[model samples]
Target: MQTKKYTRLMLASTLVLAAHAGWASDEGTLTMGTSVNYSSGKYGTQTSTDITSIPLNVAYDKGPWTFKVSVPYIRITGPSDVVVGVGKTSATTSTVRTASGLGDVVTAATYNFYNNAEAQFGADVTGKIKFGTADSAKGLGTGENDYSVILDVYKKVNQLTFFGGIGYTALGSSAAIPLRNVFSLTAGSVFKMDEKNNAGFAYDYRQKSSATSAAQSELTAFYVHKFDKSWKTQTYLLKGFSDGSPDWGAGVSVGYAF
Candidate 1:
């Protein structure tokens, strides 16, 4: 599933990580990373809202199984009606407000069903849960949990890798904030520039969580560089074509594996 800022990075990173973490490795690998992301948009409003997020992520991969978690601290300067993760709701206001605090916590587990080294084909299934740790009073989140299941597949041809996935999410709802279950899709390709670098572009789409909000559609271009066997970095720029997404966004992250 897709949200904004930090969530966007997680989705893209998952694809790249899966591509790099081949199924041949029987030993476990631990990875940790952090990133700073920023996005701004009107969300069909007269006044623009800006959001900044810093997320800490950790993941472990062993054989066919992968486990991951992410937590974010967010700062929002916008209308009180705008909600983090879900974006603008039915409520509207011209008054702008600023709030800062913890955002949502996300966790997931993935299992690789098949991988063919010679054929360069692989498939996986992932189950994800999003905990509403952010403060609802501050508009950081909806104060409820969300669940998702995704099926992803990839094919490698020479130095290029193509990947895509489809997912369904069950969003929790409350009296103050009603939400609907939605479906999401993502497709992308990564081109290996050399032994140490790669670049790619991905597109994400999700149905609207609320009747009033627009569907989410975004395009992101990313670059990944390996500093060494245990260290790596990633940078990305995002452009949104739908009212449900941020107008523009960017982020940088560094990760270590051991």
Candidate 2:
């Protein structure tokens, strides 16, 4: 019943947003990317999950408003329990299961609420929705929708940019477990080394999703390079600090803009 209600709301919201997209003046950009991630000891358990995903994303930016959407095809190899917010059930003889299908779809809209050119400061308000498109039977996702609102602020000084954000997520409940709404925080800074290269690091903290789960904390370092005005690539390494997070992971993505 809750899922159905959320589905209806999502559809209505999509229609309204699509209407706005249709009236937008600028041409939107489309990006395609693929990445692979491997993790061990997730959710404080001795289990591993490996995923290779291809994401298709589209974004439109005009004036101070930006709208974006992403849909990803994911292939997962691991125990089903590991993917569904449940820890490993056994230390031995736990057969590895593989699932491949569409992952969740996400939509976001952001408005620049404040900006100061001289001070090189700006703030944005963003709203996001994550639709449960992955199959629950395959244990690829929670099979419920999620909504989030975030406030982001950034300041630029010379070749360095600093950013931070705070957000709250309303996680949808599933039959197996009821998830709690959680708050999240992130802070990061990027340094532009030259016209083609940049590096940055970020720290993220997220509240626990389940009653018995630990909160999540992770640190990430990323490098980005631009081949030209239309092509770019980025790579990142992450280290998790809590049982609810992956031990370590890495991924790279290539993007194109027009």
User: What's every prediction's RMSD, in angstroms?
Assistant: 1.8, 7.4
Q: What is the lDDT of residue 135 in candidate 1?
A: 92
Cα TM-score per model? 0.95, 0.82
Over 147-189, each residue of candidate 2 has an lDDT whose tens digit, in order, gives 9998877777787877877889898886665678888787777
Candidate 2: where are CA atoms >4 Å away? 1-38, 84-95
Residue pairs with clashing backbones, model 2: none
Candidate 1 residues 120-229, lDDT tens each? 88888889898999998888889999999989888888888888888999998998889999998888888889989988888888999986677888888888899998
Considering summed lDDT, which 10 consecutive residues are worst modelled in model 1?
Answer: 1-10
Q: Supply the TM-score for candidate 1.
A: 0.95
Which portions of model 1 show Cα errors greater than 4 Å?
5-21
- Structure candidate 1, residue pairs in collision: none
